[model samples]
Target: MKTTLTVLLIIQLYGLASCAIKQHYFINQMKTWDEARQYCRTNYHNLSTFINEIEKQQFLQDAVNQTSDAWIGLNKPSGTWKWTTGEVTTQISWDTGEPDNDFCAYLHKDSKKLHDRDCSNTQTFFCMKVTVNTVMVQQSESWEGALEYCRHHHDDLASLSSSRSMTDALSKITGAQTQYVWIGLRFLAGGWFWISGDDLILNVWSSAGPPQCPAQNQRCAALDKNTQTWTPRDCEEKLNFLCFK
Candidate 1:
């Protein structure tokens, strides 16, 4: 029994360390998207491209410190967005019917999605080193409090976009976990969606399907580590959570 407990502890710590993300610099100075790109290339890696909530939160926190919206590495100038480094990764989480008639984009905290705007619009920007980190919050708390804890300590709660990502996150669960833990899944704007603005393409809800749509009383979602399925629970329900950084 002691050996088993030791193994679980080791796995938990190793999971957190394995997903650690690279650092980023918050340039609170407002600049055009093009200008920001040049500045990032010259001084840092490049305009930040975030594939998951962990990276997105890093930039979002930086943006909040500034006075206005901020330009990220995401842009759909012409049609599709290409990172500042010139690689065109297919992973894109767009708001409903977005990426229309715009050359540049900025991160919106309210919707937590890429909103297209004129490239010339000057805004603060973020430059990231390109990395990902995952952390498990063993402290039980309500969903809202869990969010606050994540923001105050690491990033936001873990958001799963793809099956691979979800599976990877589930693997971090070490010991036998009977209770549900909070994730970034929630019902918002008339549909189930990830807090990171990622589309709700993959869902492993209960056999009877997920809880009723347009959830009642600010209901949030949690991950059943044992079953690896999602379930809607009261926002006030205190539970352990997962945070990505």
Candidate 2:
């Protein structure tokens, strides 16, 4: 029997519930940015990161207090601003005339805006607890079609950049119709990369080591539902996909 590749473009399913967002918490204790981050990591997921204006406003409304400035997850570690989740900061809400010479960002209690400060500056902070990080779309689509649908409807296709993220992604795919589900991993420009811009540092590949040079058609990655490991597959093989939100 010969297997044929099929390209299926799926329509957006509006009725499906979106992926769970992070839950923010306010800690009133004064601590440096590093201290705050450690506390958040020890207790919750990480320092709070906002992806949009609505999320920012909701976090501020719930987590901001009048007593002190608050450290968030935004920081410039190597001259590039990034969230602790490994995603680069793009939709920022910096205060006017801010981010001068500083590497860490803190939320102003009064202004409700982000201002850059020294990492050593003592302040209260916000932390977030991520519940479900991605949503499994049951609709089957090719790798390119899945990427397009995910980018159009939510964030990029899910990127299991860490062990915890891989666990989170695994939890969402129990109901997938396909044996393997499409992820954001792709072989491109001579290397494998995540569409969300996270480093492919965590190795969850199966027994087979990373493919040095995959076949032209076998450039997309999918997660084996039983093994919970990543494997390269034909880009045209339609499968249910996970989308980060």
Candidate 3:
């Protein structure tokens, strides 16, 4: 059986893992904020928008290059800051004394924080593609088999890295044939990890909490449909599973 100590060490790196819940694209070409937005919409989904600190940190580590300050998806329209998704800016990652009455936001490469600038200023920008589509496969298969199936047919096993993704996954599993369904979560090497390489940012474990060290065969994670929580289960057990596409 795997020991709890081994698993705990892996949990410490949960937030450091990389996955495709959100993808950032750096555009080196200089363009005005409006021009950058149009370019992003034409090529990618939109300009980048960080949903939380974890995402912000991950983006800095994964995408930001040696470029200077760059345009993000934040802009003041009608005297209010909003993301490219049209969501009003709530959580702030502003640098010291920022928003200095400017109408557009740029991310400083050094501080990795948001600062306002004139909308007409030309700069390289970042674009992002956000996708969290989860599909429940009613076919029952063991954890390992399911992983292979998903990798062959779809993107990978579903990774609920956030509350929104969790909710989205839940919606697809309501009609699942099994009470528990395999997700991308698995205890491997020394810790539990998402097979899809996603960072485990959400805490949706059962009331009993995650097993520190599961038994040799009970190292895989499954989602409890009725309770909407995660639980360790035997990897060999056959069950329905979710896939990302």
Per-residue CA lDDT of candidate 1, range 1-245, in tens?
53344234323321122243546666888799989977875565567775555755765665555445678787764466765433344656667887778878777656666778899988888776534555777788877678668766886677765565566668765442337888877664466766654446565885556566644654588888877888888877888888887
Better of 1 and 3 by TM-score: 3
**In lDDT terms, which candidate is top?**
2
As for candidate 1, its clashing pairs are 19-133, 21-132
lDDT of 3 by residue, 1-245 (tens): 33454355334433332334667888999999999987876676668877567777767765647377889988887988877654465687899998798899988888888899999999989987667568899999988778778767876778775566687888899989999999988888767767544445467998556677788888999999999999999987899999887
- Cα error, residue 186 of model 2, in Å, equals 2.4
lDDT, candidates in the order shown: 0.67, 0.79, 0.78
Please provide TM-scores, in order, for all candidate models, with all chains considered together: 0.48, 0.67, 0.53
Task: In candidate 2, list every pair of residues with a backbone clash.
Answer: none
Please give the RMSD of candidate 1 to the true structure. 14.8
Report the number of clashing residue pairs per model. 2, 0, 0
- Per residue, candidate 2 scores C-alpha lDDT tens digits across 110-209 of 8888899989889889988766558899999988889888878986688776567788888889999999999988886688877655456678888567
What local lDDT does model 3 show for residue 97? Answer: 92
Candidate 3: clashing residue pairs, number: 0
Model 3, CA-based lDDT? 0.78
lDDT for position 194 in model 3: 71
> Roughly what TM-score does model 1 have, to 2 decimal places?
0.48
Which parts of model 1 have CA positions greater than 4 angstroms off?
A: 1-131, 176-178, 208-218
